[model samples]
Target: MSRSKTDKPSALVATRPDPFRAAFQQTVELLIQRRADLLSETAINAYVDCDWLTWRGGSLKLTTTGENICAQLRNKARLHARA
Candidate 1:
């Protein structure tokens, strides 16, 4: 059937934010702030899979790569806000 001009888009067809990116950012923030206890399973897995996080002794820690990524994320966020 032909659609009408005023018809609203279906909710199922709506674009959503990337879940992985959201989780990754949350993970990075928590790790950088030393709040690992607040991290979710998805966040931990995403960071570990990207090699941005690591286990040190009995605690979760950010690798050097993780630190660099966090810095980049911060810079990007700042730029986006300015825009």
Candidate 2:
């Protein structure tokens, strides 16, 4: 068997990370497990710590910081893939 320089070896390719997704999933699981109404005040407080946490909403209703944090985390993840 032979390989060419134009064909990248599988080992050389980096995988993308999805911590934000993991966090989001954990949060949702907590929401369900605790039976906390999504509208409950305590749930809101608990979820807000993620900084860029967002719920489904219109443009103005989205959590700006939460969205920003997720974007940055994803971008940083991409940077890591480049390394």
Candidate 3:
């Protein structure tokens, strides 16, 4: 009689982080401390890597997508405040 054989998974997918998460969080923290109408490029750059951050004009402004990202951070802060 032949016996059925099953092989376990050989290799798992290797995944690495963006390597910018820490910088992103740092930028968010600084912004939270400022709690101002807008954050400056210098400040954001000081914390987060400029590679991902982008802006224009003397007054640095977040891009359309950045706004969404900031909004999410704000929401998280609000949720945390209640806790």
Candidate 4:
């Protein structure tokens, strides 16, 4: 019922971000940047599953949600770079 002195405060125990997810998002960002070499059948399917991409005229296209996500990623990158 009481907090232990050995226990770390939640604020001090920051969770590290997942590198794989970050890498995947960077891949998606590349796709948005028209890096055709990065988009494969499996990658397309994965993006589609997340509703961040769609098939349009037999070509992969970003959905509205995808655009928003890409924008957020770009902003975050910019902020991180500034920092």
Candidate 5:
């Protein structure tokens, strides 16, 4: 028997690990840590473009999405450390 599209896994789901996951995580960590010197202009631009971050009074600020990402990353880090 064949399954319908809804019954099967969504095509949007990734079958393999994202190669850039670690780099992206590190970038997010740097953003959360407010490590300006560690961040590239391209990375900052990408974050701004994605609405993950914003500029306020010449300083970068985290949007709600960025806050959530930081929280999730921190939680994962804590969990990994415990493991």
Candidate 6:
């Protein structure tokens, strides 16, 4: 069996441990902690570009994808804390 380029995941697709994802996750964590003001413009742009966040009334709002990612991050943190 053979796989075509379209059949395989694109190299550009982000996976776990991706820097961009990590940065975005960190931003989300800060926001969840009520420290969104600490996020840089780059991080905000990355999240928006990735569709994990959207602008609402001049403020960044988490999309479903952002919420899921934040949930995953929280779970991982809890696991590490338990260990």
Candidate that would win on lDDT: 6
- Model 3 TM-score on a 0 to 1 scale: 0.36
**Model 5 lDDT-worst window of ten:** 8-17
Cα lDDT tens digits, model 1, 42-68, are: 767656655667788977887776676
Error of 5 at 74 (Å): 0.8
- Over 4 Å off in model 3, which ranges? 1-53, 57-59
Q: Could you tell me the lDDT of residue 24 within candidate 2? A: 47
Q: lDDT scores for all predictions?
A: 0.65, 0.46, 0.45, 0.62, 0.64, 0.71
TM-scores of all predicted structures: 0.59, 0.36, 0.36, 0.58, 0.56, 0.61
Quick one: best TM-score, which candidate? Answer: 6
Can you write out model 4's per-residue Cα lDDT over 4-58, one digit (the tens) per residue? 6544332222232345235557676676687857667676665566566777987
How many residue pairs in model 6 have overlapping backbones?
A: 0
lDDT of 3 by residue, 1-83 (tens): 65333221111101213333334555655545754245555546632233234445443344554455557666877998999
Return whichever of 1 and 5 wins on TM-score: 1
The residue pairs that clash in candidate 1, if any, are none
What's model 6's overall lDDT?
0.71
Q: Judged by TM-score relative to the true structure, which candidate is superior, 3 or 4?
A: 4
Tens digits of per-residue lDDT for model 5 on 1-83?
Answer: 89666443222222313433335577766756878678889877766655666889888887786676567667888999999
Lowest summed lDDT across 10 adjacent residues in model 2 is found at 8-17
Where does candidate 3 clash, by residue pair? none
Error of 5 at 57 (Å): 1.6
What TM-score quantifies how close candidate 2 is to the native fold? 0.36
Score candidate 3 by lDDT: 0.45
